[model samples]
Target: MSRPRLLLVYPATHKLGWVKRFQLPSLALKQVAAATPTDWEIVLVDEVHEDVPFDGNFDLVGITAMTHQAARAYEISDRFRSQGKTVVLGGIHPTVLPEEAGRHADAVVIGEAEPVWAGLLGDFLAGKLQPVYRAAIPDGGQLSIPWGRRDIFSGKQYLTTQTLQASRGCPYDCPFCITTNYFGKSFRYREPEDVLAELATFSGKLTVFLDDNILGDAARAKPILAGMRGMGLKWGGQANLRFAEDPEAVRLLADSGCIGIFVGIESMAGEHANHPKTGSRYSQAELIKRIRDTGVVVEASMIFGFDDHDEGVFERTVRFLEECKPSLPTFHILTPYPGTALFDQFDGEGRLLHKDWSRYDHGQVVFKPKLMTPEQLYQGWQQARWEAYRWPKIIDRVMQSPGKPVHLLYNLLRRGGISRPQ
Candidate 1:
């Protein structure tokens, strides 16, 4: 009468080198394990920074994968299924294409998994697990499982492990984004008390929030900031530029130990600005000052390769970054990720360069550029990256940062070695 052996794995994929050192067992994976019956023995493997041991004896395997890692995840599923183990697939990629993933897995969970994982385990035990189990977005009573599996993250490059999400989903669905597709157009916030209790667990560690838009809820956000300030934990995360519009919000964020924020400005002026479906709310220059004034370092993201972009785009974008004087820049090529409005538009226009999932990452050009050749797009991206990461430019931005020196130093290191060849 042995208990079921549960295996949970996060699939491997290309990630920023800096982030690889900080990769931890995903909170979602831990939540699923938390919901499962205690009798079940669980093994967790984060493929990004750990090797998967094939010798484990597991009756059930669950994998979470993003679009870029779908191919590898399916391969793992196939290998495990060949060994007679039941495989379950979930996460953004599988949720969107359950039919395709169904080919490799015995079951696939669609959308948020908490409401579905327990019943899913029951179904598996009865040998009645359906091909697809759609998880209902939990009601207000749902308890967010605090991440408690730091043992799985030992021996990683970065020793600090701190992550807590105060909210889920984003209201503004930019055309190129798949966030709204997966999480929905409306944002749902965790109660402030719940979020603070979670934050309180971290004591003095540097936390990184995984929220898509932390400030999407102004009222809920203020209290969370106050709680974080009271907790005195240093943290960083993504938020739309509009968070800067409210001067009070900016001050609270800085007071709350927010050292930096990743802002996806998208483009200075091009397809992102003119795209019929884009929902971004501010111009580049105005948003820059607002964030700087808050004393939070800015890590601005920009994309190149709009139909309106010409050869001059690279220079213009670099100049814009210099003018903005943010702490860091993330230059990406326009990509049409599956399950997004942009993907549908690209499919309709027959403009995809290839269907290769690996190249679909923002770093690569996956489509023909309207105003430039594919080679031009690649070289332009490289040039822009080099320009943004150049030593002088990095130093200039760091010196201009209003946040703590440690954050500026981290930004400089994060943008390392991007200089172009002479």
Candidate 2:
């Protein structure tokens, strides 16, 4: 007469080292828990912070993975299957490469799990679980699902446990992005009032929006921002630079308790201009200033190792970061994830160095560079992070960006003093 137990896991992408210890709560696993029936006893495991309970008694085990975490996911899946527990794998990497994932998991859930989760669970309990369950892309209105089970993350230490998503998918499809492939090419937003209602349930003063692009659609974002104005919540999310061109949208974002934003500048020298969605009418400097003028911290994301980049890119990138003085900046080596256009292009050109999934983390270089050696590209990326997070540079950026000293300081302390890979 006991209820079936469901174990949900988020696999760690790398071995836990000093540098790899920073982890945010897994919103995906919590969302999966939300979809599970209340009759089941659900336990969530984030391998980043805690050990996976391989020997735990569970009727079913569900694991989610990204590209870098695929290896760890497979290991976890194999262990659970060995214990006679039915294992299911889902998320971007498994969804894109279902066949490979199926080799390990008893069942694979492709795409969003919301639509098919109940059916899948019913079939499993009936002792007739299918090999694959594909969920149809739901409409924007369907995104107004229940909030994630935040209680699962209760005792864990995290930078921010309050993560919410108002929308799914992105309008822009950059070659290096896997989001469009997984979420589709259109923006699907939950109703503003619904999103506001969910936000009201959180007790934390800070929240992190998990939207791929929070401002993907200005009209949809406006109401959400307006709703947040009186909520007394400080939040941050990723957005495109175009958000600055619309004066009203910028004002709404700032007034809506937006303490920080992550903007993908990608490259400083207009290298990404050929991509329609990345092309900006305003210069990077202008966009950063406009966002900062609203008293919102800007965490500019820049990628190195583009085909157009040369050895001098590191110095030029550091110079731009200093000049623009965004509250915080992140540098990453361009990674070609499995389902992206960049992956296809690199695979065809015989430029991919190896199929090692662990090295696919954005910080590592996995492909041959067009203009520089792979080592040079990786070192350049490390140099950018080194220079950007130095005490002097952090102090200068903090002074340039008006308010959100706490936001700036948190970023600085998190990134500062981390030794770069040789």
Candidate 3:
């Protein structure tokens, strides 16, 4: 007569130390927890911070995996299933390759869980659970889902537990990204009132929005930003850089308690995915300056290792970061994740080094470069990160931001990562 217990797991790839505090707890798991029926008792086990409770009593185990965590996820899922726990797999990796996931799971949920989760739970309780529960991607501009269950994250440390998504999906079908293919090709938003209402309950000042592009749609995003004007929260989120082209949007963003923003410059080659084909009259250097001038710290994300990139690409990227002087510059080696167009192109050409999902973390080189060897691609990535985080470069970046102290703190934190050998 006890309530059925559900365990949600976030599988860890490796041990994390001090940096664990800054990692965002799984927003995907939080969403999954939100969709469970009220009769179910929920528990979370983030393997990064705690051991999986294999000895604990639980009726259902839900494991979410990104591509990088897929190997770890399978290990955990296989262990739980061997012990007779009903394991289910979901999230991006499972959705991308459900058949691979099904070998270890009692069932798999494809696509977003919000629409299909309760039904899966009902069927499980009814003893009629199917092999897969697939939810359709939302194509509309509006989104409505329950507020995530923060109570489930009760004892966890994170950058902030105040993370929530104001929107889902992106209009841009950037070849390197999986967001558009799986989540839909539109800026689907929660009603502004719903998003604000959830924010009102947050007990902390630091929050993060987990959207691909929180400001992708100007009209829809404005209401949420306007409603947040007096909320007294300090927040950060990722969005496209082109959003800065509008002066008022930048002002409205800064006014809305946004302390930092991450924008993807994507590549050093002229193929920056987020920019329009017509191109803006203002250079990226100018747009970056506009956002930084608003006292909102801008973290420009750049990727290296396009087919055209040669040995000199690293120097060019470091120079670009110098001119832009973003509060932080995050460099990534290009990763062709499965389900992306880039992945198809690389796989078709037999360029993939291996199907080992664990190495697809963007920090490692998993494919042969068209112009350079894999070693060259990887060393260039490491050198660019080290080059950008050198104290002189860090100081140059920090001094440019209006929020000097915050910028300096983050730069030092980044420098530590860049200094650590991969």
Best by lDDT: 3
TM-score of each: 0.91, 0.94, 0.97
In order, candidate lDDTs are: 0.78, 0.84, 0.89
lDDT of 1 by residue, 1-422 (tens): 59899988877764455567655458777667766778898888877766676668888999988888888889889989988889999988888788988999999999877668888999989888889999764433323554445544555655366766777777667777887665766667877888887777786777888888888777778988988776778888888777777878888988999878888777774444554323436666667777776777888888888878888899989998888877788888998888887788878898897887856778888988788998898898898888777778877877765655865576667666466634
Candidate with better TM-score, 2 vs 3: 3
Model 3, range 1-422, lDDT digits (tens) per residue?
69999999999999999788988889999999999988899999999899999999999999999999999999999999898889999999999899999998999999999999999999999999999998887787578889988889889888778989999988778778888766898888999999999999986569999999899898899999999999898899998888888999999999999999998887743644343421667788898899999889898888888888888888989998898788899988899999898899999999999999999999999999988999999888888888888889988988878889999988888777766436
* lDDT of model 1, residue 6: 91
Worst 10 residues of 2 by lDDT: 14-23
Q: Would you list the rank order by TM-score, best first?
A: 3, 2, 1
Each prediction's RMSD over C-alphas, in Å, is 2.8, 2.1, 1.6
lDDT of 2: 0.84
Please tell me which predicted candidate would have the highest TM-score against the true structure.
Answer: 3
How far is 184's C-alpha from truth in model 1 (Å)? 1.1
Q: Candidate 1, overall lDDT?
A: 0.78
lDDT of 2 by residue, 65-112 (tens): 988999999999998888888999999988889999999999999998
